[model samples]
Target: MKSPLAAIPGAAILTLFLALVLALGSGFARAHEGHSHGDEAPAAPVATAPRGASSSSALELVAVARNGALTVFIDRHDTNEPVTDAVVRAEMPDGAATAEAMPDGSYRLDAHWSERPGEHEVLFEVARGGESEIFPVTLTVEAGAAPGPAGGFAAWSAGLAVAHDFRRHIAEADPLPLLIGGSGFVLGIAATLLMRGRGRGPALAVLVTATVLLAGNAALGAETPTPPGAFLAAAPAPSQDLARRMADGSVFVPKPTQRVLTVRTLVTASDMLGRTSELPGRIIADPNGSGVVQSSVGGRLSPPPSGLFPRLGSRVEKGEVLAYVTPPVQAVDMSDMRQRQGELDQQIAIVERRVERFRKLAPGGAVSLVQLDEAQAELKGLTDRRTALDNIRLQPEALTAPVSGVIAEANAVAGQMASPGVQVFQIVDPARLWVEALSFNARVGTRDATARLADGQVLRLRYMGAGLADRSQAVPIQFAVENPPSELRTGQFVTVLATTEASQQGLALPRTSVVRGSNGQSIVYEHTAPEQFQPRQVQVEPLDAARVLVVFGIGPGKRVVTQGAELLNQIR
Candidate 1:
């Protein structure tokens, strides 16, 4: 049972492999010029919009065309401020037209030439405050560049064109046609299967199935009605003027909307700034300017002569009576006082009788002068003790403010029993507030400091002192607010930035410039163009109350968006 392939000999097998190699090489050498073989240069960035940018010594202008209309945005060259009161004239090859002022500070013109897709030169003349400047802008519109995916007729047409080119190459190419190369490759595979002498039928069947699928796809591509050449000449439809995020993660904001958002930029410059550390802090009352009113002994509380307790936020002066605490006497103490008073009365009566007897006896030479003096002294001492006990039951202790400030806390209630050393009211001076911060590093410098509120309000602070005691693994540092705002309250949270003597060189940007990105990285928006903002991830450190030091990911002399960066990041 000799097989047919075994009889063909080894020379024939080697010849078949040589044919397969030649067929593959020739097929690649004659590949279509449109298809790349991994040696083509990278394509340029696709034009999303037809726009022209021009700048002068005093002004910067951008003109964008959409739907046969041109919108011109003019800004100051130095400050980036929008120019609203400028007379704009547009000169094109077709005709010259005056651009009408829009409510959004942009100029609009009816440009019929913009409908044609090609490069066009437009001259923009801007006049304001008796000065005029002419700027030439070259606008290029890409031909047949669609924004999204192609489907239906366009996709089918693309497939058909590829099939057509393939068929033409197989018919007319010189060295070896792709059809011949594929047939040779199949034959080589069949020969290898025959030499193995097993499962030949199934291998042939699988190859037959792959061939059928290729043929069916080619037939379907030929049946499509769209012509092969129409795909390259298609034009993109007009889109709306809106802010959107580009594919590269940059945001495209129209100039008119930038004004509404109040976008502002700062030109970054590298300089040495004081290094700062952000500490968790809270607002506290100044110790020297604050006080607490407390009862010295257990007693009942009573209102002052004005008849009302000083309420919270009520301003009080130093030594002003806030409340009264009357010490209630127990029954036993009262009984003891009565007993003592009776004893004192009996003693005084006896002493007075003795003193009168001494005076009479002295006149009869029966008593010395020293005896009369001693009896009078004993009578006087007993009367004084009796009077002091009466006054103790009548008088009440008056509670006065220790310092001039507003009553920040109040616990005074008339007839309420108060304990000894209980704080009745707390007073704080709003103008003399202090921020207490906890610094993890014991060596945190206090050369300068500031406090930033939750609402982005910054307060200048003067270094007071730091405690030597460790609390929660951190030292407590105190800073007195200079010219504190009236809205500040005790216990409000604040971020305290304590500046050290060490200096670091970096670009300083406002705290508002940085925003949290989608991936939780800190990013800043750079005003790379008039309306285009690019997000640059940056490494920053605390610089001061209102600014941060950008140490990396951005260089100096770049215009970064200082205001509305958070709003810019919202565009997606």
Candidate 2:
């Protein structure tokens, strides 16, 4: 009999081996599932179906020859913009031919060479104004395939069923769950071995583990169907209603629901123009319109004549006294004032007595009129000095508003002593706000700049100025808000869209419409058929504040989902 420790290693090895096998099998199933059942079918002969061309650069050329004439499509690699008014010269198998430009940015040439049924390489050179590109394309022309009998529908249906079955099996065969369950079973087996001497416990545990593994494997197998009917039942059927593929490769949403979700469409058209840039920005107070109120001298703070402190969000006129800064008087100053008051009072009394004597003597000719006048003036001056000394300890300085606007910041507290030059309040005129954006490119001029707030609100921008000095390798561009709403706050971060004089034409769609593809490429779902949406990779550029310009991948008149794209991307 094997020792318990020996059994433990065996159980662990068994579990690991089983997990590895399941994982390998799962990978194979996934690979098989992604392939179409009819992949082995021969390619169909060329026909007059609607043709399209895509390129990875400025030189993708697709030419179709029909009835002794050839039609060509030319597009730029990045933006998929059509190259119009280009002089196209193609070297055919027999001779060279010059193509004429069509209104739709395509070219056409009369087929002067003999019609042949073979693969031929055609060299094409396209020139427009100052730019030119060369494209080499191979065209294979063969006899059209004959139509099959109507009864062949069953075979097509069978092939679709098989493909779906493969997909279902692939989804079910994910091995992580199986590996976990297998680990649990092996642990149970080890426990059983450890308790070998216990009555019936080891046998019971072994039986239970075997039963669990068999059941679990059976469940995993049952998840995928081998027959056509089983596959149909397992897979979700494509709904008659229009559906779009989400970012995560999931499906099943209706068009009416999409419209309710604010789904908008864009028709792609491309042209060569200037490139745009998006920069991070923030909402700031206009320097000319915002001001901070600070105390000029240190003293205790008190409310103005209104007896109420100006609270935050309160509007105040320029130069309005918002608070009172009462200059604090020390005990020594108070004592000095009191002493001066007593001295002035005594002086006044002595002068008053002298003045009284002088007035009596002036009438008796004992004193001259000048002496009486002098004595009276001294008594009046002494009385005035006493009154002035008393009032100095009672007055306080008033703190006034520096600007005419709303109080955005208030740090004032009642009876709090404030230091000299300490900012007590910040005033901002909300009606005249500004946005500061950091631009990596030096902006020659701003044409149609706008700012997008975090809450999705967009503010119109008027160009103020661009700084020459570089900050963090970016220039600061200032834009004054044209119409600011109440929700806008100072120092709030925002996204600024600054338009340059250069122009480019492309399919402009809402920024939310594009999603990241599995391969990490930018992709948008094209409503290809009535009920199916195919993912198309696109090259995107900044268009404006709310939208992105699709330069490639789709064409004009195609439908796309704008809103609920993220939700669609979440579908598995």
Candidate 3:
């Protein structure tokens, strides 16, 4: 048996196609016979509502008309924070309508008039505290249609269905109805031939030509021709509703959002940045300004007459008695002292009686007068020895401050036995502090230096001397802090920034400005535009205690984010 397509000759197929085209054209011409070309436009998408925007130097306002009402979102001109507690009034054609504040920091106006399609002007009067702004907005509300499906095929079907509706409406200046019907008929016939084992190659050509004609007709009926200068002036870019990460791997933050995030930028300058090598250092007391109070002999620790030991950070003057160490006597030493005291007391009593007898004899002229004088001298010597023995038991060693400064360390406690040469208190003049930094390479002629604390506090430094002895395979460099601030403690850790002979040219930025990207690369955010921030991968080197040098990936004279950069990276 022959194929079904073979029954129909090629000439018959050509004649049928021509008849179909003629019939479609005649139907379009007859339907639009009496109609004018100036008919109204088709209704707009039903899912979309009209929205208008107005901005001033102090505020930005967006008004959306939805479900016969207008919702207004008022934000600061600089910051995106929703404005609240502002007396807002909108002037309508009938009268002024005051907007009611909503809980989401927006205002709403009952605008049933917005449902009808028309061009209207609304004047917004906003007053907040001492600031007031007038935003005149022009809004155009258009008739909308229900939203269509989300696929290309679904859109084509929807276009065909709308074309079918136009068959009864116009079908005249609009060729969409004939294009839809002719394309569908050609596709159906081609599909029937393929299912009946016809030629696949010919069927494909037919489908392609029909699809091309369909698209061309749609474009010709819908799109209008434009002049060469039509694109000279471009439309303004729409404001971004939210901060997001762009597909190019850059963060897009609006200017208002940038202000809300408190983002700050610094201009990059190309200069000779001092090459620095980070070294672990610590805060130490100046040698000439610090002193240690220690005991000379082993004795028990005792408080001063003021009855309290000097506390840590206690201010003390030179020769101020911080504490007293009472010498503890052994059993044998106590026995020897008691024996000396008794003998001295007995000798003094005997000499006193002899002196009195001598004086009496001298007055009576029975003995020589020189013997009486000798006896009186012997009594005086015995009495002096007796007094010296009593003093040895009561005297204690006094521990006094050797320098006028604050006590940085205290170890003395009441009744505790303190060994000789043991430091009881450390008195350091806080006005002068020193920093000892260790460097692997010895810096001989280095002078300019700085020390940064962990809390970002910087201190000026003057070059002292570097130690000749190698400690931990590194040389120690000391720096005297110029104009040291209060609350500097000894042995506190600090980062020393010493300028070496080497120099580099780059932009210096705070350490906080750099952040680690998801790819584990060192990235710095550049404020590329007023409302856009782009992450720049950079090769960063240590510049100083608080700043780092960005050598590559970014050029000078660019505005780089110096503050709130990390927060900006967290968006999206």
By TM-score, the best candidate is 1
Assess candidate 3 and give its TM-score to the true structure: 0.58
Note each model's CA RMSD in angstroms: 9.4, 17.0, 14.3
Tens-place lDDT digits, model 3, residues 440-490: 987634776888888979888898889889999999999999999897788
Candidate 2 lDDT (Cα, 0 to 1): 0.68
lDDT by residue (tens digit), candidate 1, 1-572: 87746555577556545555544444344344333334332322323468889988678899988767889999886457889999999889788989999988889999867777689999999999999999999988766543444456556656766765565444245535555666666766776776677555744554555456545534433343333465533524336457888889999997767888888887789998889888999999999999989999889999999999988899999999999999999999999999999998999899999999999999888999999999999899889889998878888899999999999999988899999998999999999999999999877897669889999899999999999899998999999999998999999999999987788889999999999999999999988887789999999998888999999989998889988999999998
Cα deviation at 115, candidate 2, in Å, is 51
Model 2: per-residue Cα lDDT over 1-572, one tens digit each: 65555534466556645654554455445544544445443322212312223243444556755545667866443333355778999887878989988866668887634245566677788887887777776666544311224335546656766665555554445556655665576656646656765544564456456545555544544453444553223232222224444454545444334434444444455555555677799888998899998888789999889889998898999999998887788999889888888888888889989998888889889999999899888888888788777767677888788789999998888889999989998999999899999988785457758778887778888988888899999899889999899878988998887777777767878888899977899888764432235667899888777778888888776667666666666554
Stretches of model 3 off by over 4 angstroms after superposition: 1-240, 346-385, 485-487
Q: Local error of candidate 1 at 513, Å?
A: 1.7
The residue-level lDDT of candidate 2 at 421 comes to: 87
Q: Which stretches of candidate 2 lie over 4 Å from their true place?
A: 1-253, 271-274, 305-307, 339-388, 440-448, 467-474
Worst 10 residues of 1 by lDDT: 37-46
| Ranked candidates, highest TM-score first | 1, 3, 2
Tell me the deviation in Å of residue 162 in model 2: 17
Give the top-scoring candidate (lDDT). Answer: 1
